[model samples]
Target: MTMTVRDLRPEVRADVEGFARVRRLALPFYLVTADSLAYDATHAHPDSHYRPLVAEADGEVIGTAQVGLVHDSPDPGQGYLNVYVHPEHTGRGAGSGLVRAAEEYLAAKGATRLYAWVLDRPGDRAFAERHGYRASRSAHFLRLDLAGGELPPLQDPPPGVELRPGTDFADDPRPFFELDSETMSDEPSDIDYEFTDYEAWLESTWKHPLFSPELTTIALVDGRPAAFSAARTDGGTRYGTVMTGTARDFRGRGLAKLAKNDSLHRARAAGLTEAFTGNDAGNGPMIAINKWFGYEICATEMRYVRELG
Candidate 1:
C-alpha cells in the first residue's frame, strides 16, 4: 500500500476526528479534541506557517504531523514537526513519509534547524537517530488521579494575598497576560520566546476551547495577578494544567504552588478524574511542585534537533 501525506482539512469532520483519534491513542497524556484541532488549524499565526499533515493509507489517516516555525522565538529559522503514528499502524512507512513531507515543507520555508519530540522509547529514539536527529532535552508527562487520590486540602491565602478564579479577570485579562509573559520568560526551554502580542494570546490561549476559566486559579497581590494556574479540560473527566507560574518577584513565596493546588482542588470538585501535565527535565522547581501534588511521571519524550541543509 502506498502512503501519501497531505494537509489536514479542518473543514472536514472526518479529517479532524481522525487526526484527534490518532493523537489521543498515541499520546494519551495530552488533551486533544476535534474542536481543539480545528481551532489550532484556523487560528495559527500566518508567519508560523503552521501546517498539520496526515499520512493516508487505503483512504485512512494513519499518522499525523504538526509542522510550524518557532514564530514567537527570538531566533529565526527554527522549526518544529511532531509526528505521531497510530500504534497499530506503525511500520507501514507512514511515519517516514510524514517526516519527509514535513521537513521538505520547513526547509523550503528557510528553516535551518528542526526540532521534533519523540517518545523516549527505543524504537522512537532509533527512528530519530536514523533521520539524523540528535536528542537534546527531555520532558515528562505526569498524571494524577483526582477522583480517588488524596489531594492536599485547600488553604486560606496568606494575610496579603488572595486566591481567585481566572474568571474574575474576564473583564480585563491584561494583568494575567503580563504575569504569564513574565513567568514564561523564566521557563527552561530550547527556544527563547517573548509574548508581546496580546491579541494573539487572546485568540490562541484565552479563548481556546479547552481552557476552563472557572477552574483556573489566580493569586492576587494588591489586586493584581501575581501568579496563576491555567486549567484546560477535555470537556469531560480529563483535566490538565496547561501552565502554572508566578511572576519573578513572587517566585520564592510558593504562590505558584498555591495557585496550582487550588486549581486542582476546584477541578476535582467539578468531577474531573484524570489530571495531566508536562514539565521540562531541567525545571526542578516546577517538577518539585507537581511531585508535591502527588503527580507521577507516566511517560517521557526527548526533544530531537537536526540542522537542515
Candidate 2:
C-alpha cells in the first residue's frame, strides 16, 4: 500500500510505456508515446537537465512528471515540473510524492523559480496552492472531430500565394525555423524565448519523432514562407497542430486559416480521427480562428508559479 517515486529509465520499454500511459490518462489532450518519451530523455539539451519520473504503487505506475530547466529562456534559474496522476489512482499520495520529488530535483540543480500546469478544477488548483504555488495565466485545449464532424471547406490560395506541405523543405528546414521563431516570439507568454540556435532547433523540433512534415501545411507568398500549420501525430488516429501562425506582414490576410484548413484536410485524408490544439486564454485572435474551424474547448489548465526557497 506504499507509493514511491523514482526516475524513469528510458532504456526500459515498460517504464517509458507506463509513464506515457499515465500522462495520456491524466491529460488526453497531449500526444505522448514511448518513443517520444525516450527521445526526449535522450536528446534533451544537457543544460536543461531534463528528467522524467514515475510514481509506483504496488509496482504499478500511477503518476508521472516531466522536470526540466527552461534553458532557452533569457531568464536564468527557471525550471518546470508538470506532474500528472492517473484519474483512477488519485488520492493515493502519488501526485504529492511526484511533485515533491520533482521539486527536490529541480531545487538541487539551483532552480530559483518553478512553473507547473494544473487542471482548471477546484481540487487541482487547491493542490497547487497548498504547495505554495500561485495561479497565473491559463490555456485551453481544443478538440475537433476529424472523422465525424465537418471541417471548414478547403479554399484555394489567392493570387501570388501558394500552399505547400512542410515536406517541400525536406532538404532544408531553415525557412520553417525562421517562420516558427518569428511567430513564437510574438506569442503571449510569461517567459520570453530566443530561438537563435538553428542547430538546436534542427535537433529538437525538426527531427522529433512525432513531427509529420508531409501533413504540415505551409503558405508561401512569392516563394517565401508566410504562414504555416505544423502537425504532430501520435502514431495512431490522433493528430494535433502544435503551431499555426502567419508572418507579421501576412497577418489578417486569412493565410493562416488557409494553411490550417489545408493541414486538417490532409490529416483527415490520411485517416486521422481526432484533431487537437491549444491556445492561450488571452489570445483572442487564435482562439477565434480555432472556433471558426469547429474546434471546441474540451479542457483548460492554469499555469502556476512558485519561488524556490
Candidate 1 has a TM-score of 0.99
All candidates: TM-score: 0.99, 0.98
What is candidate 2's local distance difference test score? Answer: 0.94
Whole-model Cα lDDT per candidate? 0.94, 0.94
Show where candidate 1 strays beyond 4 Å: none
- On residues 157-244, what C-alpha lDDT tens digit does candidate 2 reach at each position? 8999999999999998999999999999899888889888888888788999999999999899999999999999999999999999
Clashes of each: 0, 0
Per-residue alpha-carbon lDDT of candidate 1 for residues 117-163, written as tens digits (9 for 90 to 100):
99999999999999999999999999999988989888888888999
Q: Kindly state the number of residue pairs that clash in model 1.
A: 0
Q: Which clashing pairs does model 1 show? A: none
